[model samples]
Target chain A: EAGVAQSPRYKIIEKRQSVAFWCNPISGHATLYWYQQILGQGPKLLIQFQNNGVVDDSQLPKDRFSAERLKGVDSTLKIQPAKLEDSAVYLCASSLEGGESAIYFGEGSWLTVV
Target chain B: AQSVAQPEDQVNVAEGNPLTVKCTYSVSGNPYLFWYVQYPNRGLQFLLKYITGDNLVKGSYGFEAEFNKSQTSFHLKKPSALVSDSALYFCAVRLYTGRRALTFGSGTRLQVQP
Candidate 1:
């Protein structure tokens, strides 16, 4: 089985610019998630999707960040008017529908906003 | 609100010695605990989880974690540390009730010396 896939292992953008990260989860996985991991910190849940609908996104910055999983197999996270504080690693993970299942993760996209 | 806390920022241990990484969590309902490992420039990997059942759960790479419901702690442990086991470890928790989203700790960096 293939692992989760993420694009542009590294990215750099100026403040106020827009950036996007892509993620393709493991085949047959029913749940997908996006997380932000700042330096010296653990991964923070940005959003979670079960199939095409969102399960949770309470912690996401609604004003600047948005994510979608249209077909439910792949997802894209976007940040508009990126700020220096947004610089972090964007990690994507997938898992089964059950609450206790272990989640598989991708390599992640490292973003640096200057 | 569910939350996790890793008390130590870093831990140093000599190879072949025992190692432990402490974690504590808070939640309203039953808690689902997880441990993940991240190597340099890599995404988080599932180490183990404790949803229910036994108190001690063994996971990949000779890692194990003890779930203490009374103390609300799930500390990662290994009997004999290896140099290759040096990495960043994160502890996470989720509530069993509605709208479950993972709450992660800051993370603990493990350094194993030869």
Candidate 2:
């Protein structure tokens, strides 16, 4: 089976610019997630979507970051007015409906904000 | 609140030797533990998870994790390490209730020398 897919494996933007990342999850997956992985740290969940409905987004920066899963199959994560701190890899993952299922991730989109 | 901690920043092991990576977690309710591996410039790959049942869970690439409820720890282990096994490992946790997303640890770098 095909794994989760993401676009623009690498991206670079200047501070104050806007950037967007896209994700297409595995077929029949019911849960999608967006995570940010800064250097020297683990992946941090930015948002989660359960069938197009948000399940959790408490750690997301509302002022600069936004995410949406339209039709529950594809997702997009956007960061407006990017800062140097936003330079990190954006990873997208998907899993089956239940919490017991394992999550598979895409290759990720590496963003470097200068 | 749920959180995970990887005590070691890096672990070095010679090829064919046994290796261990330590992890601890904090959660209000029952904890769901997970292990993921990531290569350079890549997203995380699911290694295994411990939701319930047996405390010892075997996962991909001959890796296993032992879950200790008393200590609130889940340490990843491998009997014989290979150079290809070198990567970044992350431990994650989530409560059984409330949130559906995971909180990841700071990640441990495994360096297997050939």
Candidate 3:
């Protein structure tokens, strides 16, 4: 079976510019998630989507970051007015409908803000 | 609130030797523990998880994790380490109270020397 897919394995943007990352989850997966991983740190949960509906986004920076899973199959995470601190890898993962299922992650999109 | 801690920043072991990565967690309710491996410039891959049942859970690539409820810890272990096993490992935990998000540790880098 194919794993989760993401686009633009690497990205570079200047501060104050906007960037977007895309994710296509595994087939038949019902839950999707976005995470941010800074250097030397574990991936932090940014948002979660359960069939196009948000399950959790408490850690997301609403002032600059936003994500959406349209039709519950694909997702897009956007960061507007990017800052140097936004330089990190953005990972996407998917799992089955139930909460206890194992999550599969994509290779991730690395962003470097200069 | 739930959180995870990986006490070690790095672990070094000779090939064919046993390796251990320590982790501890804090949560209000029953904890669901997980372990993931991340190669350089890649997203995390699920290693194993402990939702319930046995204290020992074996997972992909000859990896295993021991869940100690009394100590609130779940440490990843492998009997024989390989050079290919060198990577970054993360420990995560979530509550069983229907909250679907996971709290992750800073991560541990494992280095296996030949």
Candidate 4:
């Protein structure tokens, strides 16, 4: 079975530019998540969606970060007017269920904001 | 509020020796723990999870973690480490109640010397 799929494995943008990352979860997975991993740090939860509805996004930066999973199968995370602190890897993951389930992750989209 | 803590920043072990990476977590109710490994410039790969039923959970790449409820710790362990096992390890936890997203700790770097 194929694992989670992500696109644009690497990205670079200026401080005021915008960037986006896409993710396609595993088949039949019901939970999708977006995480940000700064260098030398662990993955931080940015947003989580169960089906088309958001489950949690408390840690997300509301001002510039936004994510949506319209069809529940694919997701997109966007950062508008990126900052230097936004230079990190954006990871997309999926699980069979919302809670108490093993999650699988994609290769991640690396973003370098200059 | 849920949180995870990885006490060590880096650990060095000779190949074929035992290794351990420590982690602790805090949650209101029951905790769901997880361990993930990440190679350089890559997304996290699920190593193991401890939901219930067992104290010791074995996972991929011959890695195992023991859940100690009394101490609120879940430390990843490998009996015989290999040079390929050098990577970053992260520990995560979630409350058994409302939120389903995980809170990850700062990662620990494992360096296995050959």
What DockQ does each listed candidate score? 0.76, 0.75, 0.75, 0.74
TM-score of 1: 0.97
Give residue A38's lDDT in candidate 3 (0 to 100). 92
Cand. 4: chain B TM-score: 0.98
Clash number by candidate, in order = 0, 0, 0, 0
> Which candidate, 3 or 4, would have the higher TM-score against the true structure?
3
The full ranking of all candidates by lDDT, starting with the best, is 1, 3, 2, 4
Off by over 4 Å in 4: none
TM-score of each: 0.97, 0.97, 0.97, 0.96
Candidate 3 Cα deviation (angstroms), residue A95:
1.0
Interface RMSD (Cα, Å) for model 1:
1.2
Q: Interface RMSD (Å) of model 4?
A: 1.3
lDDT of 3 by residue, B1-114 (tens): 889999999999999999999999999989888999999878899999998999999999999999998998999999999999999999998788784777799999999999
Q: Write the per-residue lDDT of candidate 2 for residues A1-114, one digit (tens) a residue.
A: 999999989999999999999999999999999999899988889999999999889889999999998787999999999999999999999988776777889999999999
Clashes of 3: 0
Write candidate 1's Cα lDDT for B23-106 as tens digits: 999999899999999999999999999989999999999999999999999999999999999999999998876647677899
Error of 3 at A34 (Å): 0.6
